[model samples]
Target: MRTALDVHISEVGPRDGLQSVKATMPTADKCRWIDALAAAGLREIEVGSFVPAKLLPQMADVAAVVRHALTLTVSHPGLRVMALVPNRRGAWAALTAGVHKLTLPVSASEAHSLANVRKTSAQMVEELRSVVALRNEVAPGVPVEVGLSTAFGCTLQGAVAEDDVIRLALACVEAGVDEVGLSDTTGMAHPAQVRRLFTRLRAELGSHAGAAHMHNTRGLGLANCLAAFDAGVRSFDSSLGGLGGCPYAPGASGNVVTEDLVFMFEAMGVSTGIDLQQLFAAREPLKAGLPGEPVYGMTPEAGLPRGWRA
Candidate 1:
């Protein structure tokens, strides 16, 4: 991965990682975690999702969290402050909250889409149209990213066809999303499959296709990420302490672990630019914030494999 791959790792721990656990962290604790990560050299972080509290109790403080993170993001214009929105309403709220990037999930598996968002794949595409329209109307330059979850496979639908993933990815781009992210929501992806699908999507959608959101469920999380990097994906999403796993999503953990990922890239000389020590420090606040929740990651627990750079 060091030779030619120069991927940018975006930590999703605060947003995706925390939302999976059963406990909730105070908004101030969330801000402190974000700052710790940023000071550690992380260029981007997804602060939280703007979903209804009734749906996900973990993300109930998303609005306030985003507001707090906004203050810090101003100091580093290169740093991205992003949030996840489930629908048009969430997107609108995120835009008003002053987030730099907004991502929406669109499942390629129709059955999974209905189960997750209560809408068919087609209906979700239509909803994205309105999201894009709203972004253009209010924040014209703001980036709108569609994280197409379950792009590889779904627990509900069993297997998601490659053709379906490609089709929905193209549709998301056509629907006006700035970038379409491929996610292994259930962690059923293989390196070869990731290489193939990413290649096809890149050839078709060009610049609109990017990012890889993988899970550690199958233990191929980092391997799949390297495969995506090999296939030309620059943006990779991960979470600190691997905090999140959808309650309704069976066997699906949150995105990849941030500590392990940064260790993999920076150790391999790929230049993630994130300090492992500071990243580990960020997790302390997360642990304190969400007490009683089990956080995941091996590198943090192992201490960066003996004699590593700070």
Candidate 2:
């Protein structure tokens, strides 16, 4: 299948990727990695989270990391600096840091939401109401993104109903989200499921939604990404060297590999505007950031094959 579409890949290595690993990337090194990725032409990058330092030591300096990322001069110039906020407090911290975008992780699976974040679906939406209220009051210009995690299935619960995910997505948007996106938190998403859910998501949210965040834990990340793109999703959430996963979910692989997703799109005659070579060039600083961290990705390990072009 072929279509004329442009895809924007967002790197989540600094936040999602780093948080998965036990070792913390030095604050400075993390900025360098983010800079390298930006140089590679990635438009949006989720720098880190605004969660408590004691709970997530790796992200103890997330605010500092986001500030550093915002300082970089990327190709887009006004890069999208994204951070995850677990609650209203985190949302306040993220806004104070001047982040370009703030995303909240709202699990669609009821059981997963309660177990992972200790908040039921309704409670999470309520938190969004407060986060949205704060953003409207202090930074009305800043956009809030609700990443509907476990939209396809859950680790604790077997299968996540598509209806349930869609309902929560609608609720989040109604609560005051500028946009909404779906995440395959457990990597149980199939390409068909990706297409179906994202198609429904767009139908519900209209022109107010974005990318698909897929995990490679089950090796379907890239395939699922293609499905979402086919379903009208342009932006995507990926991590450098595939170095991320939910700290709570064990089998979920890191975000889909950035290089791999970019390669797939670029190879299929789709323009991502991201240079494959420069994208891989980012690996050095990424490795330098968190030494001993196991960065995952097929493109990084195999290197771009002969005659590849972006």
Candidate 3:
């Protein structure tokens, strides 16, 4: 995936974006949105999470959505259908659905971990090990990625130490996850902190270092992403229209906008293998699914610069 594109943009709007909003997008509309995204040249998309319907009604039809997205692989051969799995049970469900990849969110902050998953960081690592065992048995080839949320800092527990983030990442790597990525769960990360953590993560974890998932809450999302790229990150996680936040995370809102991020890279002459105009077009279904919902982005709203070519 990285070889063809200068940077890998893993669109997480379907899974991360819809889960935060109050409105539960209809299943058919979700498929239509995913179809639009794939047609826009997004090679990897997190279709949905496998959590219980009672917990997140927005994702109740995740299995069906994944099935629909899989059909697109026939036309977009490089498209990778992915899902977020909170635990072993969710992982089993995602594996059974034949998803191409799995992402597990593990918080570095103990307070956030307990509230989000009802488990401490250590307990979550153990949980990940169990999930890895299941994946090895049922789907050995499938990659399991862990997103270390709150790696920057936490609203509940202020000042998450840099050592704690690295320690947790190493623990997850030891637990058998294919990759470990840092997330600004509360959007508290600055460029310097982002650069430091990712630099250390790559030095220690090497090839296991993964995508940079930054939030735009403090308006530092793009800057932090640039810092991560400077620190040697090639893969990134973004939401179309800046649609994301953690319901469990109070005061946290907004993910890095896909349109703006692509524009930033393409303008710098770095290829993302995505069409800028087509990406803006994908937002139509998103708005159609959730009428009156406010979507955020500078590039799409401003339109491409005059005489611009991508």
Candidate 4:
């Protein structure tokens, strides 16, 4: 059970943010950015994805990035290094790299699933089962998270049914994933929908219900996050500087800004354990790594509110 004061913010800029853009952040700079984030008290970060370099050139150095993140875990014992794995091969690479957590994206919308991974949602669930079995065989302690992307609404196939989302989540759980999260891959989720779906997710999966991956494309990312938080979601996934988009779903913006999300929690008396100022400072390495890349954040631009402390 999570108290109102506890909120876990997982930074995903290195993997999700970088994968969407054409520019590849230097491996060394990625480690620097991740170190800065951990230093800012961010306990979990999706360091990189274990995908083929030809598929996502930006994540070409995932192995090296994971090694660097592991060193940070040595320094900051609570830090969790996570990576995204698309299939069995990626999962093998992530397990070999010794990531603390691995997230597999399973699109809830069949159209999006076929487009994103060339598999149907059910096929992806079967793939998840294989990945989970591999994890148990190799590293039983490591956790596997399934991000049900396009759960809210899909551009390729609009109006994703809530029942479908729930069914898919159950399949993932039966497949042995440690957690299953909901992702607004297209940023089409409203606050009411976010609350209702998250509540349903909790009712169905209980502690297996995972993070809320919201997008700021429609400007409701933070609102939807707050709704999910109210619905008892403790973990939240965001990208520093709002730097991500979906390759399969066109016009999808970056994730909810990490700086803004942290501020929202810390200001509301929820302890995110993040240093707002240091989080802002972490953006420098991002800029240096991807020159000319657009990094968006309201808190960084407006500065802290008058008389406010985090």
lDDT of 4 by residue, 197-260 (tens): 9999999999899999999999999999999999999999999999998888977989999999
User: TM-score: which candidate is best?
Assistant: 3
Ranking by TM-score: 3, 4, 2, 1
Where does candidate 4 clash, by residue pair?
none
Which window of 10 residues has the lowest lDDT sum in candidate 2?
A: 1-10
Weakest ten-residue segment in model 3 by summed lDDT: 1-10
Cα error of candidate 4 at position 143, Å: 0.6
lDDT of 1 by residue, 1-310 (tens): 1223377888888887777776777888888888898888777789989988898787888888878777875675577788989889999999998899998889888877887889998999999999999999999988988888888888888888888888888888889999998988898898999999888888888989878999888889999999988888888988888766665568887668888888888877888777788888888888788787777889988776666655
Provide the overall lDDT of each model, using Cα atoms, as 2-decimal numbers. Answer: 0.84, 0.86, 0.96, 0.92
How well does each candidate superpose onto the true structure, as a TM-score?
Answer: 0.95, 0.95, 0.99, 0.98
Give the lDDT of residue 90 in candidate 2: 95
Error of 2 at 84 (Å): 0.7
- Candidate 2: lDDT of 191? 95
Model 1: lowest-lDDT 10 consecutive positions:
1-10
Clashing pairs in 1: 13-240, 17-244, 20-244, 20-245
Q: lDDT at 119 for candidate 3?
A: 94
What candidate 3 gets wrong by more than 4 Å, as runs, is none
Tens digit per residue, CA lDDT, model 3, 1-310: 7786889999999999999999999998899999999999999999999999999999999999999999999999979999999999999999999999999999999999999999999999999999999999999999999999999999999999999999999999999999999999999999999999999999999999999999999999999999999999999999999999998889999899999999999999889999999999999999999998899999998999899975
